[model samples]
Target: MRFSVFTLFPELLRPFTQEALLGRAAARGLLAFDLIDLREYAGNRWRKVDDAPYGGGAGMVIRVDVAAAALESLEAVPDEVILLTPAGQRFDQKMAEELAQQNHLALLCGRYEGFDARVETLVTREVSLGDFVMMGGEAAAACLLEAVARLRPGVIGDEQSWRADSYSSGLLDYPEYTRPAEWRAQAVPEVLQGGNHAAIERWRRDRALERTLARRPDLLATAGLTPQDSAALLSAGLSAEQLAQVGAPPPPRKSRKKTPAPAVPES
Candidate 1:
């Protein structure tokens, strides 16, 4: 996939894309990245792209005319342009998977106070990493790039690796331990060490269930539960009320109290 990033700070974004999984993916010809410096499209001798907000505000806002010109000048424009901002729809694994299927995308990053609200008319949609603020949108663009790029075929070198990623099944990933089998008094679960494939798989599934219920029960309702999973979760202390939460809208983030992780098979 091709990603053309519109950012005032390409320096902050360039090194990240050139060195991580994104780098490797590019090396293998599975991904392409184009960093479009917004400053290059600025009209002034100073290459200034922002100004004091209209009607009074704290920081400078990116001027829409300059941004509109930049978008117009793209040699290879994308059909979908995702503008990063706190007000946009929240981004997640599901969104990433959908985006990965697109042949190309344009990620527009905002700086200072943020893009002029009128700039919204120039792109496909807006996306947010989560609920909080950042110094700029470059970091968020990089995150969206990595999330979408790594899902493309041949990017990870192992198809199964990403299939087990957190949220792939609408549940958090199970815990993993490596290197020191015994660390800080915690031993690797015997099921993993016993060389029994069935037992290990069973252990992983149960752990994923227990962990999701404890930390994100809102997910269980749509986790594609099987009869086996229902029976197991019931044994693991999932209640009628919690079960009803299935298919219901997920609770507000950071609002629900955590439930204790119920026990699953350890041996």
Candidate 2:
């Protein structure tokens, strides 16, 4: 896959494209990265890319013209043009996998107050990291790139490696341990130590469910819940009351104290 990034601060994003998993992908030509400087498309000697909002705003917005010029210069049409903005859909693993299927991508990184409103019209889609705000979209784009890169064939050594990743199966990944079988008085789970693959797998799934139930019950809303999964949960000590949580229930009401009112001021 190829990614074309349009930003004013290309230097900040350079190291990420050349390090760790990303670096390996780039070296193998499994992934290709292109950095485009919006300033290069600027019309003036100073090459300004941002300006005060037309009506009024606290911070400057990227000028639509500058961004358009950079986008227009691309020799090949991008499979998808993504404008990174907080108003867009929250990005996740599923989205990353979807993006990896695209042959090419153009990422428009916004800064200051954000891109000019017109810039949205130029892109095919928009994505946000989360509900919270960030200083710029470059870091978010880098994160997204890494997430997508790891899913690409030949990028990661083991194809099955991602199966156990948190969010891959809509459950938080089980805890992992390595090296010292006995460390600091804490021993590794016996299931993992024993050479029984099936038992170890069951242990992992059970622990993953337990962790997810404890931390992110919200994810269970749409996650896979098979007969075996239900049985596993039951075996893991979760009662029918917990499985019922997957279905509807009324909002919990506050329990009031039963203290009686005193006939105090009997004036």
TM-score of each: 0.88, 0.89
By TM-score, the best candidate is 2
Off by over 4 Å in 1: 247-267
Clashes of 1: 1
lDDT of each: 0.86, 0.86
Cα lDDT of model 2 by residue, 1-267, tens digit: 999999889998999999998988899999999988889988899988888898886999889999888999999999999999999989998898899889899999988999889998999999999999988989988988889888999999997889669998888998999989998899998889899999988788878878887888787666777666676666666677877677423324457989997778857
- Top-scoring candidate (lDDT): 2
Query: Per-residue error at 202 for model 1, in Å?
Result: 1.6
Cα lDDT for residue 155, candidate 2 = 93
